[model samples]
Target: MNSGFHGNTFAVIIAVENYQFRIKTVDYARNDAIAFQQWLINNLKVPQENIKLWLDVDATKSALNEELQYEISNLTESDRFIFYYAGHGFYDGGYNKITTWDTHPNNIQETTVSLNRILMEPLRNSRCNQCLIFIDACASYIDEQLVSRDFIADMNTKEFSDFVRSSNYRAMFLSCSRGEKSYGSPELGHGIWTHFLIKALNGEAPEAVERERFITSTSLQNYLSKIVPDYIKSSTDIRGTQKPWAEVSSSNTFIIFEVSGASSEGSNNYIDFIFIPERLIIDFENDLIIAYLRGLENDGRHFLMYDYEGLKEIDVEAYCIRISKLKNEIRKILEEIMDFLMEYEWEEEVIFERSDDKFNISAFLYEDDKTREITVSLGLSLKISGLHPMGDTIFDSEFDVANDELKIYTDSSDYNVEEVEIQEIFSDCWDEIRRYFLLEKEIEKELLNEIDE
Candidate 1:
């Protein structure tokens, strides 16, 4: 019987406003809000059954009524509950307050939610193992000429102190250091810190982390530190602070979060091939020949060459080693081909062949490998039967570089002939030819590695 229980659950609440009071001049707050939701759903691997997402432009006291409170209360029984707020925060004389859409700077009491009430009453009592709160509140001081008292206040308070002292499993990440004001820009779609947080979650910076590295909080924090600053500079006006903060429960266990199981081997192979698109055909042909030769070498096979009743010297060991090396190269190329297939969503089978002073390579693509959809082929022949020609008719004028490029020359008069038309055909086939050879080179490198090992 299967013994593993279902993985942990997470709940996220993004509350932008408190009472109906709206704070103006948020640059990318809306986009940040949406990105956070997607990060939870797609990257964080949060289960839908356990997720309760609360999003509002302005969440007033009435809006967060009994029903919303019940839902938020029920989420406490979950494994983890995360609350994220990206709006204005005010400080009354004693308590830290979050502003609603209708809040006024002069009258803080009418449109604000006490931070203590939001966390201690509903969230802390929910019975969750962990509660993480992210706040990007904008607090500023105005002179007495404009307002009776300073609206911005220090984050430290009795309620905050009590929560910190009492809740060991609770953690909080603030946008700015205490006493410093957090600023936003029209360029960044959200607060600078929040922007980086989204990127870290998306697995975009330093490339996405392997599924294995994402299990620990330390790894996740490391990833966040590396990625957030760059994203902030690029997209937002606010710069990230030197010391970002995070808190995790001492007793909490790290869990490996698996995003997906699709192998990355094929993607790497495809990238290598695309890097050197030319030489693909020559490489593939060479690899195949080498594979065949290696098999012969292993089996103690020999090819005898006779010229006009004369016998050539035979060295069996030398041939075996050479073929073995070639076979190794071929195997490497095949590995790359497999990787390329996995990275991209393409259905194609690659084939290689060589005959009578000519090397030919083809790719057959299908909806799936089982059904043939299309066939594209390129051939290199010494006889120039179907060679693409240079426009100049004088053949001896230009020196032809062997295997570097296929070339043909036709006079104005011969251009009308069907043979000249073959030049156009092969010219278009150059891209495929290059790709085949590139694949071959990668295979060769792999073989070299195997031999060394």
Candidate 2:
């Protein structure tokens, strides 16, 4: 469990599942809001008094405005603020407004709460160092009496961008892209976007590199962007319809949540060698693409290394330390992948389990009344050089370097699976495993040069 205390954090969570007017009821909005409030309390350790929750009829235009302004006024420069809404939003009379329980569709401008006034303005004017706005509304609404337009026009316009950029510590995360509906799933028992969000807050989100246990605000956005779309395509018939969006202008990346079971042994000083997309550099003059990890030691001394050999030659102890760290990282990645697969409620009985230091992913495919079962078993193989007294193995291969070497082997399963989706999942996991290794783009460039010659 996350033991971190965020007493300074404040939130206003609003969910309107059943409107007083004859508006179409939003499904599972209340559950999503409640889940989020609980997460703030349980995971972030936010005090209950700091959070104000408004459900159904309690979410009125006047109430919302008063609460928002009150919260904003109470916030200090050192504090953090979060505003969340999961309800119906509409664009009417050239204004984007989130509907209150008492909002009549015919009088949208008067009865509804303007998003600019209720959400953006206060967030901009607040002295808080970090503010997050999560709007799960904006799905197209069906009302015969009123002219309903997509909320994207107001959200994606120039004024909206300016509103986001006005403050350096403000970020807004929307559930879907323009003209796309944010969906709720019966299987997941919450809004599809919020369900994945809860999972991410619970620490199932991958792609975080800076810290193992803490999910930074930037990483949360990136994780939602990657996982939501893929899961939608695989699970729902509306494939490629919903994509998460974020307009982040925060200069500092706030640590949002401390994840459970994230820390591994020797993980504190671990250095990654992966060619992350943002940090990757191409060297045309040298005919190579370079990716490296540079970091400061415990004593504040800095070091840079392009490959394992450099570290091995400079400090054997450091090299061995990295070997242990990478080994644990590889296992952690596989465990996360297994956890992800277990979330799918497949019709065919699928067995996902880990035992004896290996992950077994078994699923059945049904085609034309014929059932075929495929199982992918994953494990690691470690080969240590005879430099240390504890291990010695005689092999045909000859070593060029006299220092110790550690070789880790993954992808032991059969790649030629019948299911294409399973194949893709395996391939993705393999790519994640490959991220902990040396420079890949340089190797690819060298191979291409050889092929060209």
Every model's TM-score: 0.46, 0.57
Q: List candidate 2 stretches off by more than 4 Å.
A: 1-7, 92-95, 139-154, 157-160, 207-210, 268-453
Model 2, span 1-453: residue lDDT tens: 112235589899999888888776788999999999999899777899989999998999899878778778778877888888988776666556788889776666688877778777776776776777888876443435322213323343234546666776666778875445688888988988899888887776665423565665666777786677778778876433465766555233455665666664545534533211112232333433223323322222121111222332221221111323333444564555445544654442222223222122211111111232222223321122211111111111111111212222221211111233323222343344234222344666799999999
389: Cα error in model 1, Å: 64
Clash-forming residue pairs, model 2: none
The window of 10 residues in a row where model 1 has the poorest summed lDDT is 271-280
What TM-score does prediction 2 earn? 0.57
Global Cα lDDT for candidate 1: 0.43
TM-score of 1: 0.46
| Candidate 2 structure lDDT | 0.56
CA-RMSD of model 2: 17.4
Best prediction by lDDT:
2
